[model samples]
Target: MDALEILFTASFWVAAIRIASPLIFATMGELICERAGVLNLGIEGIMTAGAFAGWFTVYAGGDLWTGVLVAALAGAMFGLLHATLTVPLGLSQHVVGIGVTLLATSLTYFIYRLALPEVTSPPKIEPFQPLPIPGLSKVPVLGEALFSQTPLTYLAFLTVAVVAWVLYRTPVGLAVRAAGENPSAVEAQGISVTAIRMGAVMVGSALMAVGGAFLTMSAFNSFFFEMINGRGWICIALVVFGSWRPGKALIGAILFAAFDAYQVRLQQMSGGIVPYQVFLMMPYALSILALILVARRATYPKALMIPYQKGER
Candidate 1:
């Protein structure tokens, strides 16, 4: 078929949804922490840790649910590490985040190499199947694109609404916002900024890890050192692009995923007619442009990346 047709087909939208799910999950998690004034750069490490942990668990004869549970737990541990360094110790968020990423990524590789057999050929497990909603699956193109997805995909989108509600409606949500906007005021309310920040980091890290687990379990059923492939960085850019809102972040993720989906398809269909490198670079390039455009006007938590001390302001 033609390029336009290929881009607009039902299959394309399905691919877009599939490709974007992980980012949506990560972005949602980041939105939570960012709204609370903590900038987590350790997302890369968290995701990598999740991916390997999930893959390793499933590969070792555990069920998929258990594998995902282990992934989230692993991610939370990493998140706890980040919180310990940033929240209580008051370290540089960027420095500690990058360090976590380095440690987690290298640690995953080391663990995988030591634990698994036949390291050269990555092993696989039966990945989660798409559970198409009964009647909804029969609808037009939109049906399959939206409803016919793995359970995780549904959860990722559902999380957007859940996050929105939690951020804008609930009492703790108010505290989270307060923590970001005015920790001084939060302290005035007798709330502990350090505690809230810790919770946010732990939750965000778990979600980010699920995103990474999505790579190993859903996107492709195997472990690869390069599977994360900077998706975490793209997510950081997306956070700016989304302006720290769940809805905007979801939209930005889908947009980027659409470009990514199209890029992969175009490469296959064009068959050397187009430079493959250009297609490969599309998502990252768009992310850079998106960040540049959004960074100027995007609103952030007032105390973001600023270490909060109890008595000092």
Candidate 2:
């Protein structure tokens, strides 16, 4: 099929949505951290650790859901470490974040080596399968794309909705927002800014881990090094692209995913006429262009990356 015609195909959209699932989860995680005035640079490492954690759990004979839970717990622990150093002790966010990433990645790799001492090929697991909604899956391209996906994909979309609701409609959301915008104001209201920011980071990190888990548990049946392939960094960019809103971030994730899905098809159609590298770069280039256009007008939280102490306002 031609390039233009591919956009309308159900298969193309199904691929796009499938690709978008993990991004949705990670982007929401970053959004939460930033909303609460924390810039988590450890996302890449956190995701890596999570990918291994989940895959390893399932490989070791645990259920898929258990693997996901283990991944979340792993991420939360790292988040706690980050929050303790940055929020309470008032360290540099950039340094600490990078350190966390390095630490997590190295630790995960070490664990993998120790566990699979002599294995060359990674083991595989039975991953989640797609489940079509009875009535909705019959509705053409949209239905097949949206309604027929693995349970994890459904959860990813649900996470966006839940994040939006919590951010815009709940009292806890108000405090989190305030912590980012003006921690002193939050303190004035008798809320512990430390607790709010730390909690947000831990929860956000957990989601990020789950996003990584999605990779090994849903997108593929086996684990490998670098499988995350900088998706965590892309998710950070997506958070900014969406201006830290869950709904807009969801759209951005889908848009990027579509570009990715389209590029692969284009490569097939090119029949080696075009360099594969160009096709591989298409999604990132497009995403950068999109980010530039949207981020200029994006209103970031005033206190993002600024460490917050309890008092001394």
Candidate 3:
């Protein structure tokens, strides 16, 4: 293909991966948590909290890496809060998640307002540069498109593979699945369902936080108000679309991103065949379709969304 054709064809795919990265990471996190019997609606809130923490870290120290670390730590703290309220207190998961979301959003906005005090000089940082693979960059059409991406981009793919293995190929994976499907049965076998679920939430929250941090520290280098923009809900959709499987969910996340990326391209195209707002709705629309497919499959975990009491079935 000619250079112009290559650029036109590759642009959408590149944008797709870029858009999909955060969702991929966050959905994987949600998969872990849900597979442990917790439907964490607080993902949106957790992401917002991470965005603020990462932005603040960069603003204070002028280092993106530091911001990432701080964001992960903040996420873990949120996860702990989630576990405490839902696991021990036995609060309703939906209510607790919404509360966490509200708290995180309020806290983020409050801290951002306090730090800047004015929008005239909002804090910003330099985004991470993409690193092209050696020799691979010279390949025909695929080189620049695939081999040239940020470190985190590669890490996102690796996470999918690793999570898939840990969730399906190991003993710990079996235990987590058992705990989610039938916590009472797992507990009868001497496994601590509470501990397993707690671990899942903590790890999942950390991943979600990094997904938020990626927006500030890598994608844009500056945080804006409500930067996450419903990406968390998208993650939940991806988990359902993937049937709670890590690898399949990653593909679904990429497909969702592709829809988003295609919309941007459509806006730039000459004829303007598709309305901007309609294009923007594509991801959510696709997610709704996915939800329908899940309903048909009926593959949800038996114990999903149920609060486990210590001695109850």
Q: Tell me each candidate's TM-score.
A: 0.97, 0.98, 0.93
Colliding pairs, model 3: none
- Off-target runs (Cα >4 Å) in candidate 1 are none
lDDT of candidate 1 vs native?
Answer: 0.90
Task: For candidate 1, write residues 199-235 as lDDT tens digits.
Answer: 9999999999999999888888998878898999999
**lDDT (Cα, 0-100) at 27 in candidate 3:** 93
Which tens-of-lDDT digit does each residue in 99-204 have in candidate 2? 9999999999899999999999988999989989999988899998999899999999999999999999999999999999999999999999999999999999
Comparison by lDDT, 1 against 2, better one: 2
Best by TM-score: 2
> Which structure is stronger by TM-score: 1 or 3?
1
What TM-score does structure 1 among the candidates reach? 0.97
lDDT rank order: 2, 1, 3
Clash totals in order: 0, 0, 0
**Model-by-model lDDT, in order?**
0.90, 0.92, 0.82
RMSD of 3: 2.4
What TM-score does candidate 2 get on C-alpha atoms?
A: 0.98
Clashing pairs in 1: none
